[model samples]
Structures are given as structure tokens and as C-alpha cells.
Target chain A: MPTRNDMLLLTGFVAVVLAAPFLFEPIGAGYPDLLQKFAIFGIFAIGFNILFGLTGYLSFGHAAFLGVGSYTAVWTFKLLSMNPLPAIVLATLFGGLFAALIGFISLRRTGIYFSILTLAFAQMSYNLAYSVLTPITNGETGLQLSQGDPRVLDIAFGRDYGAVLPSSDLFGLEMTGYPGFYFCGAMLIVCFYIALRIFRSPFGMMLRAVKSNQNRMNYTGLNTRPYALTAFIISGMYAGLAGGLLAVTDPLAGAERMQWTASGEVVLMTILGGSGTLLGPVIGAAVIKYFENIFSAFNKSMLGDIFSFLPESLQSGAVSVASLFVGEGWHLTLGAMFVLIVIFLPGGLMEGIRRIGALARRKKPGGGASASTPAE
Target chain B: MASILTVQNVNKRFGGLKALDNVNLEIEAGTVHAIIGPNGAGKSTLLNCFIGRLEPDTGTVIFDGVSLLGIKPHEINQVGVSRVFQTPEVFGNLTLRDNVMIPAFAKRDGSFRINAWKGVKRETDIEAKAMAMLENVGLARKADEIAGQLSRGDKRRLELAMCLVQEPKLLLLDEPTAGMARAETNTTIDLLKKIAETGITMVVIEHDMHVVFSLADRISVLAQGTVIAEDLPERIKGNPKVQEAYLGGAHL
Candidate 1:
């Protein structure tokens, strides 16, 4: 049922995602670790948008689902098998289960109260996983696969790793480096396709109605609670898949993933890239990850090299000033960019792109009519 | 004619304020019934009780032989009742067509369904029906326009179209022409007349005597939380009690 424009968008999206390694080489983000993070967080942000952007339910505890997914994946690896497929599947299921529990409770309230309830539940979960749930989560050290643990499925399949720990895999392809990135990238595409379908569906329309006017929806004989809960569960599963992919690439699950800061990061990504648009969240994720990895790597010596063209006294002063905006201060740059984007383009980066497109079309003789259509 | 809605011995209190004091009314099928009252006559409070928004302290509200009390607003709607608020409650962020289409979907799909796999564009039948409803209200030309940007009269019309798309057994309209110019009010009266011709039972709450006389088959005049008069529109105009309670004995 996709329109021609939708088909074209999907084709272009797939092509760009598949060619990311080469396309990003010039920008110095072609490496596998950062590329994997991009795909993983992209999935996370897109899922978050389904709940936050469409329904206007800004969850500040989505990181709890992400962390739950990672722990589930790690447990699957340690107790069942090293196959990333089963690990990922279990992670998504567990994540959805957790979301259902939390959503049922938190959704009883709305507005700022709902936000606070979700935050409270997530903090409770983080504390539980960090301290009391040490038997399963490994306390402060995090949950990791051990050679001594039983691998019922792997042993049954005649796979053996005597002393060295084994990385998660899909059949014979090891999930590490480029292969790992490709695996996560493929999942990202699948997730994007599913999100796209939901966006074009009746259910998505109902979710938007919930945001528009719950009282109207109720009087129209449409139950808004179930629709909102379903979106919450679906988004939770996506966060779980992203978390499982993280374990597939790195084989580690830590409590830090559940921190409120991690939750806020996804919110920033969605808003910065434009929450409601299809491609905005993924762009936001990539930009944030790119800054986190690339800009944070900038050192004083690198700044000195770039500013060497200036006079010696001015060069030192410039490096000193610029140094506070990169490396450990990369967050400052991100914060400034967020402020600018919110001020100049309240609709996010996608709005800027749309304006440019509108401008270009307006230059054509008859294109002005279509170009003047209001943004959704 | 069979009564579609029967309210008996209904009473409500808001902490010492008697909002509804033993109110009773009956709406026959396929007739337009208007409940006219001065301000603070418990007109809206009675409407709220019928729609499950407020729980009356004591009463029975029966619609189609089923109790309307102790049900959710959506459950009440599912039982073949729909309402248009005094202030239009259309989905402001969505297009006018979408606003109508949502109620149509609710009617077809029931209270809830996960129609996530099928594209909304594939529902051609609902699309056509939504357009037809918009055309009914004379908003078809602006069907794609955002509902929020519409004028007050246009939004009320859009809300009516939204409710009509459901084809409910009984419709409840509150102040259908509350804040409209004379021209817009006449247009709405004509539109409501057209809908009344379709044989759907309606309960209208209004203060405008002109709109009331134009649309109501029978009238109930409420004053001080009690029905002071209930009769045909012509008789009610000359009823002494109605004039004394409503207009302080002013001549009609």
C-alpha cells in the first residue's frame, strides 16, 4: 500500500544505510565501533519517536528498557547459547514484558505525573539491577559471559570454546568489527521498515488522535489507553533490540546503560533531529554519536595543529578557548547546537532541510503553489 | 413510538448544591428533543450524566433497555450514543477529513483494534465515507485543511460531521449554535434539519429560542434544577409557568 514517494524514500534510505561505511569515510566515522553505535542508537531513537513523537508521551525512562534488553541478551548468551539471534529475540520479548508492566502502572497518570511515574520506575529498576539483583546482574562489575558457564544450546550444536571466551555469532559469521556492524545495520533497516509501516497505518492514526484529544477519542468510542500502551510496548521492544545488538557487538551489559543521562540522550536525539519525521531520529542519533566519538577524541595537540596558522600568542589563546568546546567538553558543543536548532528551527534539523527544499522549488515557475503547503 | 432514552428519578449534588433534583425525561425514537434552560439550571450537568462523564447520586438512565450508568465514556458511546460538545472537540492537529475518519473507524472497528499492518490509505471505503460526511456539512472543499485553523462555526460543523460519520442511534448536541453570526446560525439550523430528516434521535441543549423552535419536535424547559415545563414547542411558548420561570413573566 506504499505510495510511489514512500517506495522511493525507502529505497533511498536503504541505499544510504548500506553505503554508510564508504559514504562516511570522508567524515572519519567509517570505523566499525562507532558505526555499530550509530545503527544501534538509531534503532533506539526511531522506536522512542514512535511513543514520544506521535503520541506526545515523553518517556524519560526508555534507557531502562535498553538496559533490560542488554541483560537479557547477555543471560541468553551465558545460559542458553552464544547465538545472537536467540539473544536478540529474548531481549526484545523481555523488554516488551517490562514495558507492559511499567506502562500499565505509569499510564494511570498523565502529563507531568506520568513522566515522573516512569522516571520513578526506571530508577527503581536501575537500583535493583545495580545492587540487590547482583546474582543475575553481577553487581558493580556488570553481566558478562564466562567460559565456566553452561551453554546448553551451543554444546548441543557441537560448538566448543575450551578456554577462550566466544563472541556472539550468527551461524559461522562472528559478530565483531565489520561483520557486527553489518548485522546491527541489517536490524536497523528492518526496524526502520516496521516503524515506517506503523506510521502509515490506522493504528498510528489512532495514536496521533490520542495526542490530539483524548476526550474526543474517548467519546468517539476509541479507547486511548490501549493504543498508547501498545505504542509503549512496541517502542520498548525496539530499545531492547538495540540493547541486544550492543551485546552482540561488545558482549557486555552494564548498569550505566540504564542511567537517566542515557535516557535523556535519546530524547535529545529525537528532538534535535525532528521528532515526528521519519528520518529525523536516525539523523539525530548519528549526529550525537558522531559528536560523542569524533569530537570527544579532539586533543590539545590536534587543536594546536588546526590553529597553527595564527600568530603564536593568538594560537595558544584560541586553542585554550576552543579546547573547552571539544574532547571532554564535546557536550558543550552539542548543547549549543541543540539551543541553536531549537531557536532557529523549532521543528528540528528536518525543518531546515524542508525549508531549503521549499526555497529551491519556489524558484521554479509553477512550483510555488506546492512549495507553499504547510509543514505537517 | 418507542422511547430510545429514558431518564428516571436522576439526582446529583455538588457538595450542597443540588445540580439535578429528581430530573426525569424521555426521548422518543426519530424525534429531535431540545432541553432549554437558563444558566445554572443543571442543563450541562444532566447532559454529563447521560454521557458517563458524571455519576448521578441516584438515578437510572436507560438507553435501548440498557443502563447507561457505571460505564466509561467510550462504553457509553459504543452503546450507540455520540455527542458534540458546546465547544467543538475535533482533532485540531489533524485535517478535517481525518477528524471525520476517526469516528468512522471507531464505528467500524469497535472500541479498540490493532490495525497496525494495514495501511490507512488502503481503507478506501472509510475514506469515501469520510469525504461524503464532509460534503454533507459543506466542508468538503476544505477537507484537507487543519481543523485547528478553522473558524468557530466551521469547527462546530466539522465536529458535527465527525459525529455523523459514526451514524449513531442517538446524538447529543450541546449549544450547537452558541456563538455564531445570524447567517452561520441559519446555515447550521438548515444542516441540523437535514440531519434530523435522517430519522436519528437527537437530544439538543440550547438557549437560543429560534434554533430551538426550528429543530425541536418537543421541548423541555428546566429552571432551578427542575423541569418547569414539557410540551410541544407551540404550547410551551404560551405556557405561563415557562415564561415566569424562564423570562420572569415576560410576554412571549
Candidate 2:
């Protein structure tokens, strides 16, 4: 059954996220630095998928909330505690609240206009954070906990939560990066499962109906704007949680976290892997994160060393060609990947997998009236 | 018998054109009423006003003791008035079953929730209801077929099934048999007769006199955005006003 596939996917994801650090320990691949980024970014991209994917509304400024979440979390740390829990929670609440405001206005204009409006608001937020709200935003440097600030919970400001409770257990585990990773990973799994459930729910059907035909939905006696706004706010909260996790893992936040490019990065992740399909964004996140970690780590010199067995004359050219695959020009690869996915693989990897699955079951994609299948 | 839907002195002006001019009519419950008219007679405009798609410049549309003026289209729909537009509105992306399931789902549960997570395949009652509606409209076997791919008659049938699932107190149909073949039209007549036995009120507009003569218990002839004649089939068939309105005798 589809339910089994969903469970298998969820369990496989949790297992991978949890066991990654340990698995990578021997190969020096799963360092805390990289694993934490993947888990958090995965969260951001997945949340973005729920909004842009299901409703067919493409938001160009999602990073605004990510920035808002990080700023809120850092403020929570500065004024309240070094604890990540309250910071993530408060940040998520603000993300939802902020999205509700934006959704209220932006939802009035749909399609490309809605996208442009969200982008403009995000840019506006970025501008304000850089200048007008400098006192709280700390300008371009981003908000950070000051040494002079009194810590109500943790042992003084600069110290970790570990310093306050020497036993190192907040939720019955060592209150360290490991625990944060597990906590975030657990939340990601739960969010994914919830999104899957929502995708299959009647409400999800209405949303698809809205996407397919808004006029008909209205005639069917459903006010569609509120439904869309609800979806936007929920997805926004998920992005905020992802941002909070970033601040939690690193214990520092920056304005660049909310940059327009950061927002585009989530969009890229969702689309490159697949939008509107469960696990699509996760695959996308892994791909992008791999490029960030593994690909960027190589260069002409390192690549030369990687394939030093070639002739001395051919070595340098090979390294340069390989650089196009991994280094400064890796964007070309990403761009190519996106174009190919859009053209040949419109459904992303999910459709390909589905096709293979169908082939395995001795059925070609349905011809005639059954061209489209119910989305998972 | 009391009228289920009452339109009184309704006036709709569209910029430079008077689309509907002081139109007044009453649709009795359990009766199949037909509105026959020539091109631009405002039959479609009147239907739009009744379904709350277009606001009238004056007068009110009273349905089941409720005022339809200023009510949103969906709210009007919930009040038991469903409209089938001139063009078939069967959802292109959904199966015939899914198309029927939409109104059934909306009728059974109030609008907006997390129904996305539930498996619609398991909603036996919804499927049964959709199938039953489909069966009456002669589309039961095409339940799993995509609605957009249905033949003209089947698409109309699907639209009818969609409207029927809502269980409306009154149905407003604008040119329901507009593009159907003669064979399809008779099937439709039979279908409408079958639907009426369930005690639902229906207001149908037709250009085909055979269809009008076959199904309508009462008929109203519209000309230049106003009703020129209203009476039983026998009376309207011989009415001089109706004869003058469709003087070419082409509608027959």
C-alpha cells in the first residue's frame, strides 16, 4: 500500500539523518558541521515545497521568514536563554504570524503577481533588517547575544546550555550538537509525515481543486483565499523552524540567512529534486548539500591531485574540466540539472521512480483519460 | 403551491446594455420549468442573477424564503440553488468520480479542512453517492474516466451528476442541451424526468422546442430581456406573443 511506502520512506529518512554522523565518522564525511546544515536546509526546502508545490503558488521571498526566524531566535537567546527549544518555538510562531500577514495581502494577487509581491516584501524586510531595525537586527552583522546580557537560564551568555546543566541532558540526552541534530531530524520526520497526511487529506484535495480550477471551487461553495493563506502560514512556520535549527546548531545567526539568494536556494532545492512529491525536496537537499560540501571542497589543484595518474601534460586540463563539475563553475552543472529536470523530467525524480515502478508492475502510464494520477 | 424561487422586478444593466429589464418569474417546487427565448433575450443573464454570479441593479432573488441578493455564489449554492452554465464545467483534471466527489464531499462536510490526508478511495459513501448520481445520468460505467474526455452528452451528464450530488432545492440550468445530438437530447429528457421524481425543483432554459415540449410542465418565452409570455405547454404553443417572438418558427 501507499501507506507502507510512506512509512518506509519516513523511517528510512529518520534512520539516515540519525545515523549519518556516525556513518560518516570513519570516512570523515559526516562531520557535525555538514550534517547539521543538511538536516536544517532539508527542513527549509521541504516546508517550501508544501506551499509552492501543492497550491502551485511560487513564492520568491521565503527567505524573509527564515531571516525573521533566525533574528527572533537570536533575540530569544540574548534576552531570555541560550536554550534552542524556546528560540525555535518562538521563531516558528513569529514565522507563522508574519506569513499570515504577508499571505493576507499577497494572496489577494495570485500567479506571478503573488510571487513578485512576496519577493518585494522579502526584499523590504531585508532592507529594514539592514538599516531601520539595526538595533534589533544588528544591521548587516545580524543579531548576536552580547556578553553584557544576563542569562536567566544558561550559565552566563557566551556559554552553551551544557555549562548550566552539567549533566548535559535537556530532553534526556546530552544537550550537545548531537542532540540538536536528533531533535531537528525528529521534527523533520514528523513534519514530513504530517505534510504527507495533509497531502492525502480532503483539505489537500480542495487545494488541488483550487489549483486545477478556482472558479469551480468558488461555485462549489468554498472560499479559496483562506485555504491558501492557511497553507502559506503552515509552510512559513516550517521554514522558521528550519532557521531556528540553524541558529540552534551554530548558536549564531546572520542577516545573510535571510538574503534573497537564500530564499532562491530553497526554491531550487524543491524544484530540482521534485516539487509536489514527498521526499523530493530531501533528495534535492542532499544533492545541493553534497555539491556544497563535497564539490566545493575540490579545486583545480585538488582535482589534479585526485587524478594525478594522468600524463603531466593532460593533468591540468583535466583538473580544469573537473573544476567545472565541482568548483566555482559548479553552478553551470546545477543550471544544467535544473533545465534537464524541467524539460525531460518534469515530475522530477519522483516521476521517474513512478515510471519505473509502473514498468515493474507491467503497466505503462495510463493512456487516454487517465493521464494524471492522484498526487501523493 | 408556493414558488420555491421567486424573482421580482430584477433589473441588471451591463454598462451600455440592459442585460435584464425588470424580469420577474416564479419557479414552483417539483416542477420542470423551461425558459425559451431568441438570441440575446436575457435568459442567460436571468440565470446568472438567480445563481448570484451577477448582482442585479434592482429587485431580489428569493429562494426557499432566503434573499439571494448580495450573497456570494457559494453561499447561494449552499442555500440549495445550483447552476449549470452554458459551457460544461466538468473539471478537466479530475476523473468523473472525482468530479462528482467534489460537490458530494463539500455537501457532506462544510468547506475547508485537512481532508487532503484522508484517502478518498475509501470514502465508500461518497463513491456510492457519486455512482448513484452517475447511474441516473447514464455515466455510471465512466466513473473512473476523466471528466474532460467524456463525450458531449456524457460531459453534460457528469455536470448534472455534479449538481445532483449537492442535493440542491432548486437547479438553474442555462442551455443544458446546447450541443447535444437528437439522441442525447432525448436521453437528457429522460434523465431530467428521472431527477424530478426525487422532488427537486428545476428551472431549465432551452432553444429546442421538442425538448421544451417534452419536458416542461410550464414555459416562459423571453424577448429582448423581458418575459413576453408564460403559461402551460398547450397555451404557450398557441400563444401569439411566443409565435411572434420566434416568428421564424426555427426554435421548434
Candidate 3:
């Protein structure tokens, strides 16, 4: 049962998410496709936080689960039906199973050694899916629905669905544009709720204990391994669900989605937002995805327009310099942001917010800074 | 008094060095038995063996009528033997209240409870029990403080609160007062004496003779990876073997 405070927080979260498309319109990410990506990746980051943020076990291979989920969801579409419900459920289950296997092996080691093990497992999966698993994954061309796909559910319903190619749907309601974004958005809310419950749960407390001191937890009569593995599997399921959504939105599953860089992207989102806090991962995911979409869209001509007031020579120089922070060179801006956050806000954006809030409170004597605000 | 812990002819070696050799000791169910030793005399090694951290090459360790050999460290703890480390191994990142609450949870819910969906704040009984444990350790005032921010003495007290919340059958202390000022040490001694009166069995390893004599009902002097003397505190003080081990001369 949620406390009164949790209920309020959830209400505010739902309100913001519901209004996100309108609110983000001026920022150029309000389109259905990009908004859906935001919701999908937000779920991904929230799941990653369960293990990495709360438990402090950095699995460098989470992309493997994501890839597995995408593959499973796409296969379900090809083999079963165009409905995303069955596909997503299968994807989550498969992702959890794969994570359980990997976690069983990887969690035996700690710190960097465990990270390396996860990385190796993910890389192995990527290599196999890219090459040897061509029969299942369809290799470099990627996996897509075939014209002769046996969508059993459609046939059972006496509907000849694959005249061309079928888009994912929820019981004949097509998953595209506003409807798709809303579907992903609703799923993100559910994922967020589960993460919130875990954060406040005793199991979450044990995971925090594992992060704080596993050795001490052991002597305190707790087995740390099962707790860690459970967190890993839960996070893996979240990644899987994200991948399923990706396939649902696009109807294509690519091996590239399971690569190390994809895993690293979620890590960036979590740490950049703040680990170990409830809203941090979702905020981080939004910030990263929003920047990825908006920053890459700006061209040199656009930059030149923004600096048109300056002299010709000076303006060109300014455009060239500023170009490194946008468009194809957007990674430079991301890297700079990461470095700044790590140095100034070690706890991520949450700490930065807290510091700013503290400053605001100091400026106003007898401000409404309650006792509940976490002490620095 | 009935024996709560019995170690018989246990031997352990790390590469070429004998970490513990032919070690045998029995701890009474309700007495504080102190083991004093110079550096490298295997006090830590012996304690590690008891907690299943190191498997002895020979002999047996029986605690509360069950063999502790080859079991996991957590299993040892579940069997009712808990240790307080030399550096105080409380969860530094958690609050002092949570540090106690975790051990309380382990004791009540056992080693692996999957209460993942239940809110921690709803566990009022556990919170009250943890608060009571903090009060016993004189840290109820600092319950909300981050444990890592606490002073060394308070951190040690928090560790004690964590251990005591489990209500272990045997409590092992490794240099519990290793790094402390005189005043802190005195306070620790008083706290420990209060704990001793509760009838919990304890095996304390210490280099501080002041702490040892003040709390130990009996003393065992370890030298060169073996027991050199075992007797009441008064007799152990007068034993020539202990005198030679510390001073290299009987008179000194």
C-alpha cells in the first residue's frame, strides 16, 4: 500500500507524463516516435537503477537482455500474432531467464571482475547474434516480419492481417503516433510504480546493504548473492520490456540494439541523473534521450542563423566552434556534461538540485524546507 | 558453567606460515573470555576459523552443539555466532537506525526473506525494536545520523547495536577497543560490562591489557601462534610464560 506521500508523488508523476508531449513540443521531442522512445528508455533506466543504483553492481552487459527482448518480441510477432501483449510478456520472461543465467555466473565475482564478466557475456551474445545465430536473428539484415509469417492469432480470428506488413497493435488498435506513445507512456508508469515499490521494500533495503558492505551483511546473517541476483533479473526484465517496446514501435529488431554502447547509454542516463534515488533514473533517461533527438537535429546553417548578428568572419568562427556541441558532434556535448556532473555533482543531477534548493532556502530565511528533505 | 564454544586441535596454514596451530579453547556460556596476543600471534586467524571464513587443516570447532566447519559465514551467523570487527564493520552508508534494523530483520526474517514489495516504514515492530537497540547503545539520539559521519566510538557502538540486535549465542570481538582514546576506552568498557551482565557468551581478542583485565573473566595469552597461558585474570598476570612473552624476563 502506498503512503499518502507516495500517492501524491505518483499523481504528480502521472500528470507530468500525461502532459509531456505538449510540454516538450517547443523542445522538438514531442513527436509520437521520440516520445515513445523516451518512455521506453525511461523504463530501461529505472530497471538498471534497481541493480546498479541501489545494489551498486554495474552490469556492463544489460544490452544483451535488451537485444534478447527485442528478438523475442519480434519473433513472437512473426510466429504468433501482431498483438504486442503476448510479445512483450514473452520478451520479459526470456530477458529474466537470460539475466538469471548471466547473474548466476557474473555475481560470483565482485567489483570490476563482476563487471568484466557481464561485459564478456554481452559481447559473446552480440557476436553470436551477429554471426552464428543467423538462423534465428537473421544476422546483419536484422529480423523483420516476413510476408508469409504465420501470425496464428490473426488466422484464428479469421483475419488475413499480412497483406502487406502488419504494424504492432493492441487488439486491432494500431501502435503508432499518439496511441503508441500513450501505450508506452502507460507501461512506463507501471514500471516506475514497481521500481518505487522495490525502493521502499525490505528487499530494497537488503540490496542497499549488499551495496554498502556485503561482507558485513554476510556476518549479519544475510546471504547477499540471492538479493543481488534478484535485482539483476528484475533489471534484466525491465531492459527486455524496453526492447519489446522498441520493436513494438518500429517492428524491427536489430542486433545493434544489444551492443555495448546501448548498455553504456543507460548507464550514462542513470549516473547523469543520479543513482539510488527514485526519480533520478527517469529524469536522466529523459535528459539523455531529449538531447540525443534535439541536439542531433541542429545543422551548421541553423547555428549560423543563431549567430547571424555577429560579423561574417566572427560568425563563421562561432558557428564552427558551436557546431562541435550539436549535430553529428553532439557526443562532445554529452561528454562535457558527464564530466561536469561527475566533478561538481557526484551524486548526479539530484545532488545538483539539492544544492540549488539549499541555496534558495538560505536566501529566504524561514523558507519551507521541511525536515523530510534529506540532510546533505 | 556450560561450554558454548569448543575448539579442539584446529590447525590452519597460509602458504608457509602457520596462521593457527594446534589451537584448542573452550568458552563458557556466560563468561567473557579474552585472548591477548602480540602481533602475528593468530588471534584474527582463530576468529576467522570460527566464523567459517577459513577452513582449518585439522581438528573441529563446535558452537552451540553444531559443527561450524565448512559452513558459510552467514550459516555460522545463523547458528548464533556473530563477530564485531577490529575496524567496526557497520554499514557506513546507512543511518545508525538502519544499521541496527538490518540485523534485526535478518534475525526475525531469517537469512533470505523476499519481502520485496512490502514497504519498510510499515514494519513498525522492526523500527521500534531497532530504536530500542539504539537506545541500549546510547545512540538513540543519533538514530537518524548517517553512520559513516559518526565518531569512532559511536561507530563501534553502532556495530555493537547491530550485533546485539541478532541476540547471538556467541559474540566474538576482535580488538573491539583497538583504536581509542582513554576516555572512549573507559566508556566502551562500561558499555561492554553492561552487555556482559546480560548473560551472553563472548570471546574477545585484544592487545589492550586495560580493556582485557577490566572485562575478561578469564584470559588466554597467545604467543607464536599458540596458547602460552590460560587462567583467571589474576593468575594469568602472574604466569611466567605470559611475563616472558611480553617482557622476555620473568621478573619484568
Task: Give lDDT: candidate 1, residue A325.
Answer: 96
Best by DockQ: 1
Per-residue lDDT tens digits for candidate 2, residues B1-252, read 889988899898889998888888998988999998998899888887777768899998898899988888778877777778677886777778788888888788766555655666567798899889888787877788877787888787888888889998888887788888889888887887888788888899888888888878899888988989999999997888788787755555
lDDT of 1 by residue, A136-220 (tens): 8897899998989798999999999889999998898999989999999999999999999999988999999988999999999
Put down candidate 3 lDDT per residue, A260-307, tens digits, no spaces: 999899999999999998888898999998888889989999999999
For model 2, residues A167-214, the per-residue Cα lDDT tens digits are 223444544567766777777887777787777666776766777777
User: Scoring each candidate complex against the real one, what DockQ results?
Assistant: 0.89, 0.54, 0.85
By the DockQ metric, which is better: model 1 or model 2? 1
Model 3 stretches astray by more than 4 angstroms? A368-376, B14-19, B249-252
Query: Distance (Å) between predicted and true CA of A366, model 3?
Result: 2.1
In model 1, which regions exceed 4 Å deviation?
A370-376, B249-252
Q: What's the lDDT for residue A258 in model 2?
A: 75
Candidate 3 A-chain TM-score: 0.96
How accurately is candidate 2 docked according to DockQ? 0.54
Query: What is candidate 1's DockQ?
Result: 0.89
* Docking quality level of the chain pair in candidate 1: high
